[model samples]
Target: MVTLFDLIVSGFVALVVLPLAVSSLVAGSPPPPPNMFLAKYYLAEPRLMLASNLFLLAVCATAIQRLATHFGVLSEPVSRSLDIWISVPFVVLLLAFLGLFIKAILTVRRANRAA
Candidate 1:
């Protein structure tokens, strides 16, 4: 009962997301080319690229977990365990990002008010 959407998502994860995650984990971030305008930022903050790649991997993993559950590939208890483990970190990260975003906005507003 695989739908077109399922096939597309699985294909994207297998072909693109998985490879990018594996490469970033194994090789770390690659050095940006000298001619590239963003090379300075890349070199200055390599961890940002790694963190983003890991976040992408986490999202793909969560998608795959949901797909597996939908297909009955995972049992109830095991699926619940995986869900808890995978989802907790993802939720925490999401909240952390949201907090940072709000903090940034408030900081900017305060600065504007002061000026």
Candidate 2:
């Protein structure tokens, strides 16, 4: 009884959201003293911590929603809304990570060309 909407949501989560979450979690680790670049610009510890917590919440929400669906607990509208709401932090984190990634790339290229 999976609908097109369900398929699309699942695909988006699997393809994009999950990767971002895992990467953010990994990158969020405290950077070494010599690697201030990561701490200051790319993946600040505070941001990573927040993103990690949000990622946990997102996982829990998804699991709960799935279990509810299986047991016929939540309605379609409620489930849809939950999915959309849970995606907000992920999307924001994704944008932030992309911005930092681009900046890091450009900085590296510039440095390489200068040498």
Candidate 3:
């Protein structure tokens, strides 16, 4: 049941993320293709992939903490540490995503100008 629920959640997230990603890529390109292969290249781009994974990791950590809390497994200290761990990755991923977005924007601008 849990596995099925997780699969559903993941599919929902993918449905959201992939279209947003494809649209971003398409908008950036002047002569965009009808369909971009975002999934094929998502993991191939190291900086973007790392940023995405870091964000996902932070989310998963929070979810796990919540589950643990529901099961009465989280003490005060454990909860505090989990929050710290979650925040660190969240901040790091935020910065990484910002940097990568800026870099991509610059690259796209350069391409537009060159064209």
Candidate 4:
């Protein structure tokens, strides 16, 4: 018999895994292809993906912090500083990813027109 905790853990795992799997499928191809258009695959969208992963990490950290708070534990002031540091990278990566996504779309469209 699965306890409530077991079910909750399974649900959390599914929530995390399903989106990643879907994103990979949507990406359609691996990164590092010789063709620029083909590189639009999930692997190639590193910046965007990294931002997403980092966001998830931040969420997990917040949850952990809350749990600690509930337990009357004090976290260091460093977590706020760490959050600021991570935000900078996330913004940079997100912008880079958006630029690449636009470029990839244009490249694909051009190829289709040429063919």
Candidate 5:
């Protein structure tokens, strides 16, 4: 029973999650760009980017774990609908991570299969 409040919470959480996730992913694995693009844009510090990327991964992992607790998927007593206030954001972020993971895996599979 997702209400307007739930929708709002989910949207905000997704917005935050996607940017951090995508930026970190890009910074970590910089694909070689074309002649013009390569020289123009490059990671300023690969080490820092890697560190920040690891930090983001840790934070997201903890968040998703908390979300699992909210879902009781990790084992806990299910509370009442009042938990929706918390569940909305947790579930949204968890789903976002799941979606990203799935997409990344699929992309890898496709590339592997192609090669």
Candidate 6:
């Protein structure tokens, strides 16, 4: 179980660090075709893939922080069950969003190529 301090520290690092790491990873990839790829995300006016990664990472980090801190306050089965309840949904949401996003990108790429 994570302590409040551990949650805070790890969550902060996750919010700040993972996004930077993901940004670097995306930066190394070939740029998306104009705005088409990113437009499907949120507001969608215009933004970098790094922005999306940062946004998603921020959400996960916040949820993780909350979960960890909450877990620290509980005991035994309660803590463990709470941890599972909190973490599982967040993870599922994250995976769902990521899969959809990747699928959209590939669809766009294929269309762009076929055109």
Best-fitting candidate, scored by lDDT: 1
Q: Deviation in angstroms for 16 in model 5?
A: 4.4
At residue 65, candidate 3 shows an lDDT of: 64
Candidate 6 error regions (>4 Å): 1-8, 11-72
**All candidates' TM-scores?**
0.60, 0.46, 0.57, 0.44, 0.36, 0.42
- With a 3 Å backbone cut-off (N, CA, C), the pairs that clash in candidate 2 are none
Give candidate 2's total backbone clashes: 0
Residues 1-115, model 6: lDDT tens digits: 4567866777666677676657655675334565663554432222344444544565555556555456565455765576676566557666666766666667667767899
TM-score between model 4 and native = 0.44
User: Model-by-model lDDT, in order?
Assistant: 0.69, 0.61, 0.60, 0.54, 0.50, 0.58
lDDT of 5: 0.50
**Candidate 1 TM-score versus the reference:** 0.60
Higher-scoring candidate on TM-score, 1 or 2: 1
Model 3 over residues 1-115: C-alpha lDDT tens digits?
Answer: 2365765565555556545545554554232233665432333333665565556656556666655654578876888788897888778888887787566666666766899
Report the C-alpha lDDT of model 2 over 57-84, residue by residue, as the tens digit.
Answer: 4665575676566558888888889788
Q: Residue-wise lDDT of candidate 5 within 1-115, one digit each (tens)?
A: 4456754555554457647766858765553344744222223222333433444554554455445555566554443343555556556655655555555556656766899
> Model 4: per-residue lDDT, tens digit, 11-114?
56446754664575466423455565545543434554544554544444444443443345644565556557656765665666667667657766777789
Clashes of each: 0, 0, 0, 0, 0, 0
Q: Which stretches of candidate 5 lie over 4 Å from their true place?
A: 1-23, 26-45, 76-115
Minimal lDDT window, size 10, model 6: 41-50
Error of 3 at 65 (Å): 1.2
Q: Which one wins by lDDT: 2 or 5?
A: 2
